[model samples]
Target: MVTLKQIAEELGISITTVSKALKEYPDVSKKTRKLVRETASMLNYKPNSFAVNLRTRESKTIGLIIPVIVHHFFSSVIKGIIEQAEKKGYLVIILQSNESYELEKKQVDLLLSKRVDGILISLANGTADFKHLNDVIENETPLVMFDKIAKMVKCSKVIIDDRKASYKATQHLIDIGCKRIAHFRGPLLPQNSIDRFLGYKKALLDNGLEYDSSLVYICECGDMSFEEGKLNAQKLLKEHKDVDGIFINTDLVAIGAMTEFMKQGVRIPEDISIVGFSNWFMASVISPSLTTINQPGLEMGINAFKLLYKEIKKKKKNSDFSFKELVLDTDLVIRESTKN
Candidate 1:
């Protein structure tokens, strides 16, 4: 209920000074800033974001759009984003696309209506059309895409080297004497999934192993779900009884396949080796620790915020900027899922 005016009156300073100090303006002395901060903290003063936006023309709020927040990868990324955004005195508003283009477009429109300073997004699986995203760019709203990104959008992007990671995973399976390797891929529209599939094929060709069409199954499921993975695995195993290895696009899917494989009395590693992407927490705790590619989710999130901050600052300066695509490296974590 306390206002900035009340704090100013108690400190015997002008409201302008109090406001400037709260915003950490360089003109305010460090001592004054410290006193203002301490008093604001003690009073539990919450600034009116709307009033601040009206005056400064900036909401100091960033919008984040993800396919699904429950996924461990995205959850870690959100944690990183929250940590970095808080340090910069910015807030984040998250929206889940739920792997639907209609829902994703609606979320984008809602965020823009709220006058968010910038947006960070990972495109949904079903999002083949990018008209909504293009609208954001045309409106001069800064955007940073992470993980699943659209190739047509000219903006900063944060992503792991999917091709290299997938290649390494498939090659590892080959080294462990796996000739018949099957790939459980996600929706083919996203560049990330396509890159992974390419890597899977490259590894087989490089190792003198024949690439079989029957071994690659495209999971058309909108979101990466365990149920879809189980069904895919069942179909693959049923069709190809000689399958010896598997490379899945996600840990969740790999876990599902593993569960199904065990249910059918098939042994893991001993009978068929498996490699998963996104080294999630549960991967290590399962009956047989999973071997996976560690996608740096937290680092990706932090880097995305830093890029968005840069764009926001540039916009304030009215400067011309070039787009950048940041590709983070991935690590192949070996565990009990594949032979050492």
Candidate 2:
């Protein structure tokens, strides 16, 4: 129960120096680190792993890891997280995995080392291994997954049902007279992507449209970008010229596709009606407004933080961790990109 402040005072050093020394920060000399450790052991000081820094008992900090930082949806999510964390007097550390599993793992380790009170993450696109995620839980830190998440990882999560959302989007396309509908989906590893794909397939079956693998295109976007959308659209045009409707994974890609289609004299909602996921800001302002699914990034962020806060509080009180999965609702927005 020995605090870093007490150790610093006893060692006649600044609290910052004591903290840096304990963390072996490069700025802290080897002699200082050894002295701090020895003096701390002599004082029977034990660091609070849950609270992280003994400096102020709790670091009052949380780590947020996302796939893409610059994304409008993700940026909004960060805004929500920061606002909520600030209300509770907590600081947030934002890290972008750039959709790399390796980078995600390192970031997690860094957060742990820094002793953040909790962690909130949207799994990287390439994260197939759950060991890094498990390590946080195993270390008794409160961990919450949002948006892109893993099903096998036993922890709290907040997400909108991508499959159900995709189903509605596809059905809208079908309702609007899109017969030969094609899909541009995310990578196969993530659950949301898999769910969206299945939902697209199911909609086809239910509506009596034959499910064609040839019509489905996989995007390497991690989170589909504009260029990927355009490239895939070109392919979609060449390979499935008869396709009359398209359900895209994200708005940015959908825009990319729409741009490409326009270049070739394809009229929006005339030659091929289209639908997109995540009602991003640009979805509404484009040449022909994009029809999209409203994924509540801000609300998801607030709710995700609330969930993590609950678990963090529970851990601090010596209570056992109880996992909860909260699913938010998604709605389809009608736009000019699709048939009326």
Candidate 3:
């Protein structure tokens, strides 16, 4: 609660002198600057952020929107974003969309009303319209997207090559002698899901295997739950007796399918090999470890925030800013779920 007036009065100096000295204005003598800093520290003085923001026209705050908070991959991304944002002296206000387009739009409006300096988001699966996102750009707010994103939005993005990564995963299954392969794909709206499906189909055709629409199961809920995976696996079992392998959209879903398959007396790898995406930490510790693509969630978050921060600086300086698309690398981590 210490104020500049109190410090100036205590030092018998003008309030203007105290302010300039604390700001390192250079017009103040080094001796005066040192003394002012020492007094401010001894008094535990905290500057009025509102006043500072008024002068700089910056809130020193950023908004972050994600679909899920409890998931391991998203938790890592949150950690990375917080770490980077703190280093730059910015506070992050996180909002979960819960995979709903309505909630996502409302959160965007809330963040804008708060006058955030920038925004970083991973679009919800149900978000098909770009008007809300476009409004952020039109309002001159720095926007950066990551993971599940909209390609039509003119903004910076940080993501892994989902298509290429999914292709590599399907190819791995094929390499291990999986001719009759099935896919458990995510919801239809997200770009990643569409790209992954394309990659799976391409891999099948490239390997001289037939791509059957019946073999590809979709997660209609957009939540991509484990129960959905189990249901799809059950459906696959009832429909295709000769299916020997499966490529799942996510590790959580893959684990669900594995659990169901085991419950039905089906042996993994010996009967049906499985591969998944986003190598969650639990993937390695499960009974039959999952073979999946390492999606680099933490790195994606750090890079996304860095890009947003850069754009924020550019906006502050009235400098021309160019959008950037950053694609991080993904690795196929081989484990026990698939035959090697």
User: In model 3, how large is the Cα lDDT of residue 224?
Assistant: 83
Per-model TM-score versus the true fold: 0.88, 0.84, 0.92
* Alpha-carbon runs more than 4 Å astray in model 2: 1-52, 221-223
> Which candidate achieves the best lDDT against the true structure?
3
Query: RMSD per prediction, one decimal?
Result: 4.0, 8.5, 2.2
Which digits, one per residue and each the tens of the lDDT, describe model 2 over residues 1-340?
7899999999899999998898889889999999999999999988765654574557899999999988989999999999999999899999999999999999999999988899999999999999999999999888999999999999999999988999999999889888899999988798898999999999999999999898989976566789999999899888888999999998999999999999999999889999999999999999899999999999999999999998888878888778999999999999999888
How far in Å is the alpha carbon of 2 misplaced in model 2?
23
Q: For candidate 2, what is the lDDT? A: 0.92
Pairs of colliding residues, candidate 2: none
Ranked candidates (TM-score, high to low): 3, 1, 2
Candidate 3 backbone overlaps, count: 0
Q: Give the Å error, residue 77, model 1.
A: 0.5
Give per-candidate clash totals: 0, 0, 0
Candidate 3: lDDT over CA atoms? 0.95
TM-score (C-alpha) between model 1 and the true structure: 0.88
- Candidate 1 per-residue C-alpha lDDT over 1-340 given as tens digits, one digit per residue, 9 for 90 to 100: 8799989998999999999999999999999999999998899999987897898999999999999999899999999998999999999999999888899999999999998999999999889999999989998999999999998888899998899999999999999999899999988788889999999999999999999987998887667889977898899878998999999999999999999999998889888899999999999999788999999999999999999999999999999777889999999999998976
Per-residue lDDT over 138-162 for candidate 3, one digit per residue giving the tens place of the 0 to 100 score: 9999999999999999999998899
Q: Estimate candidate 1's alpha-carbon lDDT, on a 0 to 1 scale.
A: 0.92
Best by TM-score: 3
